[model samples]
Target: MASLNVGGLGGYLREQRRTAQLSLRQLADAAGVSNPYLSQIERGLRKPSAEILQQIAKALRISAETLYVQAGILDERDRGEVETRGVILADPTLDERQKQVLLQIYESFRKGNGYGADDGPAGEGGTSSAGTADAS
Candidate 1:
């Protein structure tokens, strides 16, 4: 996914915090970040890394991938795949190698069924970057 500067992500974080009935200071403390830093993030004056976003998401009890999508760290079209990968990566029982192997299997299955990395889910009218039908 193409990385973008923070703007919508900041606003979205603010909304999520409010919806969770949390104040900036409360969320900052819960997320183990400084209040000022979190305020800067909410004001769009800062870009949070994926780790920081994950901490904030945990504090808000929301999906980290949602913030990742808002921050442009992950593409909306790839949200589901990325989410599955995230869950696999975060599993306590799976070792690194197992996680990687599982991910590879998942990728192969998707590609085998005409859902390659570049292709959307079925019935999405897969198109190439050039805006043409998928040649393969």
Candidate 2:
């Protein structure tokens, strides 16, 4: 298990809150936390409980698991998947819909092929022909 990354988690939360166009007080009200407490959280001065994280995630319209992973509260089972997602999201050339589509396709392929962080394409007796083609 990884140690808690308070700074990373706080930065993530602050980014999400800003992206949502919400004021500190507004998010605090939505998450049922005091504004000063939320400010402390965003400043990396406090560690929020899982419940508070969930509430904030809900207010931000994001997945609680994302916050949990950022906080290192949960062990990420698929680091590759997360990395792929980060790359896609960080691409400036892709719009939101494009990013979503790409992520959907990537996840579908991974799921259909049983690929995971620890499992290569040819996992469990399966053969990957991704880079191979027959010349007729």
What TM-score against the true fold does each predicted structure earn? Answer: 0.71, 0.57
Question: In lDDT terms, how accurate is model 2?
Answer: 0.80
lDDT of each residue in 39-109, candidate 1, tens digit only: 99999999899999999999999998889889998878888987888899999999999998888778776
lDDT to native, each model: 0.84, 0.80
* Number of the top-ranking candidate, with lDDT as the measure: 1
Q: What TM-score would you give candidate 2 relative to the actual structure?
A: 0.57
What does the lDDT read for residue 55 in candidate 2? Answer: 98
Candidate 2 local Cα displacement, residue 61, angstroms: 0.6
RMSD of 1: 5.6
Model 1 global lDDT (CA atoms, 0 to 1): 0.84
lDDT of 2 at 80: 52
Q: Write the per-residue lDDT of candidate 2 for residues 95-117, one digit (tens) a residue.
A: 99999888767766664565543
Local lDDT at 40 for model 2: 92
In model 2, the worst 10-residue window by lDDT is: 127-136
Superposition error at 24 for model 1 (Å): 0.3
